[model samples]
Target chain A: MAKVLMKGNEAFGAAAIKAGCKYFFGYPITPQNEIPEYMSRELPKIGGCFLQAESEIAAINMVYGASGAGVRVMTSSSSPGIALKQEGISYIASCELPCVIINVSRGGPGLGGIQPSQSDYFQNTRGGGNGDYRTPVYAPANLQEVIDMTMDAFDVADQYRIPVIISADGMIGQMMEPIEFKERTGRSLPSKEWAATGTNEEREPNSINSLYIVHEDLEKHNWKLDAKHKLIEENEVQYEMYQMKDAEFVVVAYGTTSRIVKSAIMDMKKEGLNVGLIRPKTLWPYPYKAFDEIPKSTKGILTVEMSTGQMIDDVKIGNNGRFPIHFLGSPGGSVPSPEMIAEKIKNILGGEKK
Target chain B: MKTIFEKTKGLTAKPFHYCPGCTHGIIHRITMEAIEELGMLGKAVGVAPVGCAVFAYEYFNCDSYEAAHGRAPAVATGVKRVHPDSLVFTYQGDGDLAAIGTGEIVQAAHRGEKITTIFVNNAIYGMTGGQMAPTTLIGQKATTAPYGRDEAHAGKPILVSEMMATIPGSAYIERVAVNTPANIRKAKKAIKKAFEIQRDGKGFSMIEVLSTCPTNWGLTPEDSLKWLEENLMPYYKLGVYKTPEGGANNG
Candidate 1:
């Protein structure tokens, strides 16, 4: 397919459909309303189902239901809406249902603002709802990456029978960019033999549930889930290393922040400062291994984020206390420009021009 | 020797964990019997709500999804939309349905999703240790309403069947009881009709079964039945509230 200029949210909807997702349930919340609107207008034409739920609580449960039936399903929302969906997401996680959830996060803490923010970093990767469960978080930086990751999310969710969250901010959701969706083929997914589809008497009735009354039984279930989380962490750590050869400083960032950091690296390069970037593509099974590959010439790691240093904790953990970690962030819907980031690096390096 | 009263294959071998004299077991049996009689045992998908019947997925011998509290209707809507040919139903109690899940049930009915809902209204939260529910009768004593359900403070009980009947998308709406053998038979028939309406793809169908929570009500099993007969049946009159010929297809 030829590249077309598409808004990020619309591309997400189209990508999901192309990935054979026939069901979408969501409640409209800003910075992400375009997703549901596009789905409503386009889904029916492709023999897909798009339902605007009564609330975010209802929307995630609807995703649970469809996914429990072994169908490809997805839901998208903003911050407060995602908060409302936490209970159902927890249930979906507990039931081990495979579905894709997109969070085009806006400023938060209480309906803060309808602008781009990565404030939901803790809520997405660290089990937003109750219980000991983790969702594989993918942070996409551009429209094309959003399209590609949105398509891959379904297969990744099914591969592990777990929910995958595409954590994009308002800028990625609202901005328009040229993108092309590549056709996905020959992906092998686990058989949803455990889904609550109708039993044909050839098999026992399937039950998709999370309730375990006995402590021992619940412990067993939790251990099984923990094992899966460990496997995902080991196999699904994805990151991009740009220009690390003989670099003195490494910038750690993801999503839209990484794009800005890339520009900052280019600007810093013009001034004889050599800085590289390690962009984590998967946020939950965070690319901790990338930190181990930091060049010997690296002096410090600079963490850039849209929020006030949410992902820095993981960066510190990955750095293993070997190097000083500097943080530069513009919280509450403020986007740090390339010049601002470049200046922060220069300041951290003692205003050294070289 | 004829095997006339054997257990229905619609239910699993799991024994009921319900309290003695509680009507949840009876409701579950009749609901499953309806599935068995309709030959939908293999083609049925049940959504279990959060309440005493949270483990209803284990008891029903069909593909089941245990839904979060008060979200069974929305879950059932998803299942029915995905598998239109399958028999899909939501089994919810008052706390899970009439109270926290009111919006979900109302919207599901409004959408006229081809699914059935077996609403078990026992008037109190049984699993949560007898808390006051939205369907708790006036003057009904509950943990939350220790002084009795004060109408001035807590408001009157919500009549879910009556409210659901008012929705044009609902194809069949009936309020039944299981206090007596005759009423139990009537409840079974109402359940069967609700499933039949769904099978016909008529629209949303619901049967509100007036049930009892003897343990929560602080009454014996027998007294609970008498209380239901004397108090509940009078307040929640037993009859069909809406029929397909009345307003189901009109919407």
Candidate 2:
């Protein structure tokens, strides 16, 4: 395993190529443009394909086409571009085509900012498109997880025959970190039993489409997707919990924000304040069960994010409003300092000083 | 007795979902014949567009993908590039290719992707129950343009073949009609040649088939063909607009 320092977005693109993704269709979007730029240079050398679509909608549709053809394909973009891709993404899921989609989420309700934010938490985990579909979301806290999770993204997508999203923020996209590329197994391209590859003497004509007019037939297809999602939840829910022994306050965060929470946890430990963090690795089958396992002695949960209280809602749902949850963060591209988070922990503990 | 019918191996046996008298059938046969004559039937993949032809996936027996409105070209680029040995083409209606997917189609041709496109221009939306399309003739009456199309209000019909012909990346561009037996023969030849160009790895090639939509035009099957001859052909003139010499692979 050779170690190399690489930016998260670039690493994500390289991992996809290594995983046998032969087509890269995308447009240049901030915080994630490096993915396409990297693909443009690398894909041709490997005898793969790369295209810069006119817009995000076009890009995602191209990905849908390539994926439907029984080849590994992917696209990357920021928040606004991702929003443009929602219609196509929903159709991809409906058709049960396997593909990898990366969203280097930036601050936004509407073209909000190009800075890092966890504002897309609900959007990514909940499928980020029209429909009752869910895309398995991977939230990587560092560069290594970015590489590992991205490679896993293809496996999960193909395993479930559904779209899998790697949800990172602008900070992770831009930051450089050392990562060791792991030798991956199960790297063979999916067979063409259902793919839109031409029907040769080996098989009859196969169509990859999503236009089911009959309500009952459409309903049955959606139900199949639901069952696949249930299977994913049963087998793939993953998270990392830290230093929870006798802790009264638990910090919950994900992606880059979770890394910041780690610094805060260390500071809180030295000050004789018992605090811990629960960093989620998978955002879709969100580690709610892990949060539920928090010690009974814990007083409350502090949810930190780079958005305006978006993920806190999920935290509240997981805790079932069983504890007093406090939210703190700067919305739209502002990263909350470790000091501020640690101070908030001290303040919460000081009032009920032991 | 067999004629070219035996050559259409890539097409399915199922009757098209298009309305009666619609010329999508003619265009489909032409594409199938092209694949057969080029000896690329086993290596060809067709991209089907949305709209009246949204169910086109059911008819093209070759491996096919249904693209969102106006995105067939972009998707074709991905599929063709990934499997460079395969012959790729897209079949789209005016609304799907001209209005919503204008950006994708233009760029695909501009980049000279090694693919063929069969653009069907019926002058009005058929599947969505008669609406104004980008190629809807000026002064033509439809569901959206009840009082006849007004060039001042909604721009003139887009001359798609002519517009794409000017691009340097485009190796061949032609407009044809399926309104009559003679025109149908010419249309078939043009479409077959477009596929031939791509088989040679020549850049982008396109054939716009000016088709008839009887139900949408409020005319009987016979009148729809007559209307296409009289009204549509006058504006979307027939014949080849551009053709590359030697049919050499540019890339």
Candidate 3:
């Protein structure tokens, strides 16, 4: 109703509740612990339940359970913890259950540092667990975007009967900003007709399952999932094209790192250097069409990331060698300065001219 | 047609895929019958774990979830929380419950999650062939334990019912075997009582049934029953470990 200042992780929790999520199951992990903490404190007030699970694996399975029982459920975790959740996420995806998952990504190869990083690009966007299934991955860059997307995530999950992920870097979780919770008045979503809410013997039992012992049945199930993913890819791909009017160079990024890219773009504009940004709002069902928006005269494409380069692979696939793609990034938690990114753009632009 | 015997209402018309003499069918019957007898079949939600009972979703005639290995308790907790008045239970095997899923089960009990679990301690992993389970008794042979389970190497079999009974949240914990018809009758009673504790919202409840795995144990069905009585029951110890009535409701 009114603008309120809220931290990113806490806002994620508030957004889920606003989306009519009544159940939260999660284990504590850095940069994302506040989500579960906020949920635990606030959910009970609304007659909701916030359960701090024993482990990430158990937490995600609990989400699967609640989702199967035909309710809006959510879980959040950092990178290592998200790794443990892959199993349950895979199961949820396979079972075609609706739930929201939040990944406040931190540095990782092992139990890496808790500093903000986009190191989990593949883990969130790509098929993290075993399967031919995909979850809609949303990389919200700011607190307001976090709030907006987190609310819509629940709806989208139910609309398509799929898990939706909101991947924010550690910086986003720790940062605070002004936001408004706009109640969703989006497209109508289907009711959970296939849920495992007991039949009371009035109807045949509804089983929430992913097991298909027969190879042919499993194939049919997989193809059915593929069709759903295809529909999502067609109808739901989202991205923001910033200052592409006459840009000769485009930097592609998402989440927190894209903010730095924007600053770099602004700085380069003052210097009369043509620079623009294509920020992906959706990772899976990625904004491949955004590449077509880049002026054919563009000298080069620079992909910025907080990792060594995970999203770059997708960028490459999207660009399909249309223009020479360049990279500027740091691994672990170290972020590149705006000046550094502008300088890299200058270098790439200079090289492309020759 | 004079109805001398009809199938338990708890089960589905689909015949079980369990191996002959596996004894999983027995456990499934009693667990479902317990729910049916309690008039909970209408509200019952089941979670089937990964093991021989992985397809329990197919057998149990109720809303069911096929949980990942050892995560059944956690899943059941989710279902129970959503429908607190409904009956939620998990059917898990020794490998699923004691090995990979120990954290979920122990924490569920600690939190006093209002759910029931039917833990089948078959001493070996049957679905993937005869691998040694955490409940495989010391000196018991399995595919993985070619030379028999050495106590020094593999450690003693975990007594799940005893360990569960020690948890205060566990309103009912019992270990029973289905080796004999009288014992089978007792197992059914224990399972029913476990569900009753959940029905009363007393707290967490678990019934650990010592079942036979003939195909995996490489024993005849009859010998498997004898093996369960002579070896497994002695270590597992059939008795009521905990009850809501402080040992008064001796199931």
Highest DockQ scorer: 3
lDDT of 2 by residue, A125-171 (tens): 76567777889999999999998998899988888888998999989
In model 1 chain A, which range of ten residues has the least summed lDDT?
A: A345-354
> Which rank order by DockQ, best down to worst?
3, 1, 2
Candidate 2 docking DockQ: 0.64
RMSD of each: 2.3, 3.0, 1.6
lDDT of 2 at A107: 89
List the lowest-lDDT window of 10 residues for candidate 3 chain A.
Answer: A345-354
DockQ of each: 0.81, 0.64, 0.88
Give the runs in model 2 whose Cα sits over 4 Å from its true position.
Answer: A183-192, A350-354, B1-7, B246-251
- TM-score of each predicted structure versus truth: 0.97, 0.95, 0.98
Off by over 4 Å in 3: A352-354, B247-251
The better-scoring model by TM-score among 1 and 3 is 3
TM-scores of chain B, in order: 0.97, 0.94, 0.97
Per residue, candidate 2 scores C-alpha lDDT tens digits across B159-201 of 9988888888899988989888888888889888998888888
What candidate 3 keeps of the native contacts, as a fraction, is: 0.85
Clashing pairs in 3: none
Off by over 4 Å in 1: A183-185, A351-354, B247-251
